[model samples]
Target: MAPTHSDHHHHNDGKKPPPKLLTLPTILTIGRVAAVPLLVATFYVDSWWGPNATTVIFLAAAITDWLDGYLARKMKQGTAFGAFLDPVADKLMVAATLVLLCTKPFEAGVFGQAPWLLTVPAITIIGREITMSAVREWAASQDGKLSEAIAVNNLGKWKTATQMTALTILLATRDGSLIGEGTLLASGVVLLYISAWLSAWSLVVYMRKIWKVLLM
Candidate 1:
């Protein structure tokens, strides 16, 4: 039977309120976290069951990240836990994939020649996330101001979208399908380079914003 809105709404209302443990966004964030193991499994489950499947799974996981945020905002169900966990889940998933994609065994077969080339863009994306996360934490501790405007940026969202698209294409190309191997790999590489530029630009912008605050 389908659960009614009222039933779902009150499901976690009974809990105490500081952290607000079980909001819809938190549930979505948890879903993203849960997907990481599946992503890892896709790479290691034998050549017959390789990155082709993993690419689709990872894309679905990325979609959940966006869906949860939209639903939370639309339904007014956002929570502090969601805020904390969502970005962490995204970071962990991206970082893990980057590491896996650069290493031997998996990297050799899946990404083909010069697997380490992927790391240039991977580092750009991951570095921005880490730097921004640290800056936000430092500001919150020192000034007790943790505004959404301060933490979220449009360029950051664009970077995620582009990065995910690129990764999915690259992963799918691992199957060596003619179309995937040729055009898709080229496209993914182009997208990745664009994402890296965006990530770097956004990082500078975020740092400048925080710097302004600190100077004042």
Candidate 2:
């Protein structure tokens, strides 16, 4: 016997609904955010593995930062919630790590000679994140055009890459026994400064894009 259209429709209704929130990509993003506390806890371990553990945790979180975005696109699971949460997680992680590095006392390392070296870039990077976050929120409140105008650019990507590399190196070398302790610490500081410059440059570009819209 041939099934009627009504019968087919009834059958389809029993199927599971598509996932909105809590998808794989979204879970990965949440995992990255959850890692923040674990990373912080590593600092309190008071053992040889403290720095190494933090470095590993941070590296894993950084990798997921890239992976989640790729999966979101490839799996066609991109969502507004994921988009909003992703950047928040990244900023939180970076800001927290920078603050920890700046505050933690070290007997001998790049910051040992002059703490301001790390403090300056840390402030610049964190300040840029805060300012840009506010700018993004304001743009979203305005017409859609403003938001589009200030979309992420190449400079922003480079800044993130360099910043992550710098933080990872700094974390691993905090104990001063990772690899060529002196050279690595110096290289990390240099990279951090570069990332700070890139952050400022990207912020300027974003502001310029929305300046006209803001006036109107």
Candidate 3:
């Protein structure tokens, strides 16, 4: 009875695809992605660098997360390529750190090593990221502007802040920068679990919003 939005997009031509990838904002995003391997390598490899190296590098990279977005807006260089690459880099960093935390687990006395609890949060965070990416792609294919309906919201920002803070603190546990080991590592785990909870809540919110639009 009704043509889908996908049918309408086929006839449209106004919105432009991303231009060349030479923009400063795009370069910053690319740099963020590039640092991911070094982040993981230093964290596990240990011998190559000092104890707190991962924490310092991670927090530095996290700063770029905000800087790139701010520059993209201030510099007027918000290309589709930057939009896509930014989140991909963030998710890559989060996933790598989560794997390390899960493998190591939280070190509580009676509880011993509880890798499964760490794993639950990792799955929750990664699964939500994957689901939202697919939704955005499909919505864009339907109507180029529709995907913005579920773009990064405030809740997503909180989730990311908690994620970055927790991951950085966890990595810092290798040294007593902020009094690590029991105190800092435990706090990091608690914050991470909180971020994971927020991640699930945000996922539900986005899915509901998109579902209503999809059915229309």
Tell me, by lDDT, which candidate is best: 2
Clash pairs (backbone) in predicted model 2? none
Q: Point out the worst 10-residue segment of candidate 3 by lDDT.
A: 174-183
Candidate 2 residue-wise lDDT, 1-216, digit = tens: 899987777668866555579888889889989999999999678899998899999999899999999999999999889989999999989998999998874554544767577889999999999998898888889889998898779999899999999999989888877658888888888999999999999999998889877777
- Candidate of highest TM-score: 2
A best-first ranking of the candidates according to their TM-score comes to 2, 3, 1
Q: Write the per-residue lDDT of candidate 3 for residues 23-52, one digit (tens) a residue.
A: 887888898889888887777764635446
Q: After superposing candidate 1, which stretches have Cα over 4 Å from the reference?
A: 1-20, 104-115, 144-151, 178-180
Give the alpha-carbon lDDT of every model.
0.76, 0.89, 0.80
lDDT of model 1 at residue 209?
78
> Which is the better candidate, 1 or 2, if ranked by lDDT?
2
C-alpha displacement of 186 in model 3, angstroms?
A: 1.8
Candidate 1 minimal-lDDT segment of 10 residues: 102-111
